[model samples]
Target: MSCSEDPTCQELLDHIYELVDADEDAIDERSRALLAAHAAVCPSCRDAVDAERHVRELLRRCCGESVHAPAALRVRVVSMTTRVRRTE
Candidate 1:
């Protein structure tokens, strides 16, 4: 049932959002380990993780209720979401 044991489980796990909430070490040791193992062999999953990180950073930097990202970055994040959803 662990994500690392099954590609399908890994993919499903990657689609979840909480992976981004965890600290880097925790993410790597836990969440990202599954996705990282899969990503090592799968370019698409690598791209998804990269994109998710970028979007999360952008949100933290600019998209909070108290702050806003540049219009262009906002648009890019929104567009990335569309692409992410398609891949999922």
Candidate 2:
């Protein structure tokens, strides 16, 4: 099944950045484990998570270790995720 058709994929996408980011507490452990398990079995989800990590690493390298997301960006991200969840 394609990623687009998989609810797990939607979950992955919705939390992709959190899953790959350095913040370990961004998600609860159980939810994180579920996402990790799904990514392990779903190549598409794995790739998406990997890509997010890669981008994060690239940003850190280019912008320094102190690289941080702007507050506005965080707001927008939360808004986007909320909209996605509402649609589902």
Candidate 3:
């Protein structure tokens, strides 16, 4: 059954973002372990989790490799952000 119809699957999907995030603080180790245990027993949940990880890896490999923004653009953005206006 799909996650859309399964409560357990839906719960797993709900935490998918935390499951896929690289930041350790995104989810506790206990929670991650619990999800892993569930996914291990559920083929549908396992496939979903794998797909999310694959997509995240693809995005990181493609977009995360971009060079820093040009210095001119950075300067313009900083100038705009630092501009102050009088309230009076």
Off by over 4 Å in 1: 9-16, 23-32, 64-88
Give the winner by lDDT: 2 or 3: 2
| Candidate 2 wrongly placed segments (more than 4 Å) | 1-7, 22-25, 67-88
Query: Model 1, 1-88: lDDT tens per residue?
Result: 1345545534645544545555452234454566556766677666776787898787777757577568999689868976876796
| TM-score per model over all chains | 0.47, 0.66, 0.59
Q: Sorted on TM-score, highest at the top, how do the candidates line up?
A: 2, 3, 1
The RMSD of every model to the true structure, in order and in angstroms, is 8.6, 5.2, 11.2
Task: Give the Å error, residue 43, model 1.
Answer: 0.7
Please give the TM-score that candidate 3 achieves against the real structure.
0.59
In the range 1-88, model 3's lDDT, one tens digit per residue, is 1222224766787677677663365567767777777888999999998999899778778879575679999789746644531221
User: How many collisions per candidate?
Assistant: 0, 0, 0
Q: In angstroms, how far off is 63's CA in candidate 3?
A: 1.6
Worst 10 residues of 1 by lDDT: 1-10
Between prediction 1 and prediction 3, which has the larger TM-score? 3
In model 2, state the lDDT of residue 21: 60
